[model samples]
Target: MAQQQETKSEPFDEFIVDTEDCEAREQAYRARGTARPITVVGNPVLHKECRDVTEFDDELARLVDDMFASQRAAEGVGLAANQIGVDLKVFVYDCLDDEGVRHVGVVCNPVLDELPAERRMLDDSNEGCLSVPGAYASLARPDYAVVRGQDAEGKPIAVQGTGYFARCLQHETDHLYGYLYIDRLSKRERKEALKQMAEGAPRYETVAND
Candidate 1:
């Protein structure tokens, strides 16, 4: 999950997660048990493109459930499969938009659509990743997006959002292509973000959330 800017100190606050929902999810995960450990920036799994998900079976269903649990446990609004070291084109999100509408679901092998350039709104919000824990940098992303994919059951799924949810969709989709939120940073910002990670982004064991 990428960090979002939720303060008025930044023009990108619209991209941040809802504080109340974040706490609620964390509590729910705590009650459920443990969360999966998040893969850090240095991990090879985070750098390579993920394989498409083909087997839509009980196994895929279980994986999606675990992903949702893991994301909630980490107090993140969205998470990609690779964030937990799974090299599959899948992601789970439980996020809110500026309107406070909750959007939750799983996306496998997603195809993203960005709004036309003239209609696109760029948000330079502060974004952080679970893989690069504790480090955050300003990133510009479109304010509206649509993603078409399938559910764990292979059913077609299409999600579209504005504001923060839009950012969440794009961020998670990028993970499938082996790109991190940091990769969207400007050259200078990317350098700084790397430095921050080098200084030590917190590392966690790939265990279930507690």
Candidate 2:
């Protein structure tokens, strides 16, 4: 998957709808808002394993671009292909904080080479996603992680993350494996979060998937 340079002025064409599914897809995409649930609970696209990335062609490149757009549109820091109903082992991360800085790259055909046998946990902070709409929770995750994966160019790359980046990587990786952030939360927390989801908060899932 080759990385495409996105101009600040021009909109991303990757996730945009075409003449075929414009109305339905565009409307469905718009329904997503910031409050959308992270798809942590209820029939999540987990269990089904994702295939590895082998080719880095035009389509793969386009998909990466769309993933970035979807992530940004959803106001998320990272996203995986599986979250958008594509069972490919690809994810995009914006190396930015909540303050809206941008460090960009694509992670393709990722392989989780290492995880701490003894995990280190952190506080449950608000987390959301583009798959499930109008939901969020203070989910717990590890503080550090080392992931070995391939870049868009098919080069073997290993990157270690700490702090929020580590947490975001783990969360997005979980999406690749069909896991949701809610799965990592306690039963009580899930109940509360689901309540907010039911109330229909504005979130990105509706916008991206629509």
Candidate 3:
């Protein structure tokens, strides 16, 4: 997804990395990943909360790899499991913060961290998603976000971000809990975003809802 702000990673190890290793780590995952069709907004899987990742095994690792592949293929900054029709609580992201520093990593069973007033500063910007392709709407989200979750191997990890990267963290986490960025928009804006998607199709293949 484009930032209207700005812009995954190691095996089950590196939870989050800065600009220096972001590209290389992301590439490593993408190289082994196979891009799958992104599921659209109306798909049933996209509408419901995803199941927690109970078993952190090779299968889960492979799913993370595939999510990275799909994110890159669709040119999105972040992607969640349900976006690809998987009902597991996981997502991959490669996004840049306000300072232009790129970050990449994976979060499984992500839970958002509550912020005190100081860190609750809001960032309002146009946001897009791979699922609701070709659509964007202005949304306000906490500029600084912290998400706690396990990695591919069930290792505890917490990721923190600011600016667009922060939005990516919150946005993807919401997907796991069955909420799209559009869902947070006002009724009119939500309608307009859907209209935008109808007017233009995404470049990548998407699952057609029944």
Candidate 4:
């Protein structure tokens, strides 16, 4: 099991959703009927670099809807298209920062702006992923980030944050580039994460096969 640790500035909230709104949206989605099965760590889709989303058509719109539905159903704060077996450069987030302010958006073909070297800060926080369910690891990531991308319709979209939200941005963007949180871990930490997965992955077999 991953040990808990407190941050100097703010405590971490691992992929927590806004309960009332998230549940309502999930219920609505269930009523309407659509949920994409989340891909797991071993899936090739999770390892391949996602392709840039070019045509913003009705198909893209529907994909965005399904992504949101799938994310809400899984109760995750952020999700990338690759996590759902889609090889597109898109991600959605309904995450919160250290102070509890909600940040929500869809980012397609994102370009990340990491903080300058002097301003960069690292936080070794416990992080989890929907794709790699039932396992968590302490990954060190920059404390702030800015991601510029587009909406489902290709309109400009940018999101910047600090604390956990910054971690979320980095994590999702990494997914677009064929990376996972475990890939950021040190060798020993990666070994522990893999062991945890070997033990707990069976619980998610049904979801993965879906």
Give the best candidate by lDDT: 3
After TM-score superposition, what is the CA distance of residue 184 in candidate 4 from its true location, in Å? 1.1
- Once superposed on the true structure, which residue ranges of model 2 sit more than 4 Å away at CA? 1-47, 97-102, 113-123, 205-210
Model 1 / residue 131 / CA error / Å? 0.8
| RMSD to native, candidate 3 | 6.7
Q: Rate the local accuracy (lDDT) of all candidates.
A: 0.76, 0.60, 0.87, 0.77
Query: In TM-score terms, which candidate is top?
Result: 3
Candidates sorted by TM-score, best first: 3, 4, 1, 2
> Over the stretch 19-48, how does candidate 4's per-residue lDDT look in tens digits?
346545545544553677788887888887
lDDT tens digits, residues 1-210, model 2? 111112112223422111244334333433442222233344435445677788888778767766665665777777788766666898877654334433355667654434433546564567775555567777766666555567878876655555667777777778777677776778997777678777886544442322
Rank order by lDDT, top first? 3, 4, 1, 2
Ten consecutive residues with minimal summed lDDT in candidate 4? Answer: 1-10
* Comparison by lDDT, 2 against 4, better one: 4
Worst 10 residues of 1 by lDDT: 1-10
lDDT of 3 by residue, 1-210 (tens): 122112122232434544567878899999988999999998889889999999999898888889899999999999999999999999989998989888888888898877766777888898998889899888999998878788888988878888999999999999999999999999999999999999997899999995
Root-mean-square deviation per candidate: 8.5, 11.2, 6.7, 8.1
TM-scores across all candidates?
0.79, 0.68, 0.91, 0.81
Better of 2 and 3 by TM-score: 3
**Which residues of candidate 4, in runs, are more than 4 Å off?**
1-33, 201-210
RMSD of 2: 11.2
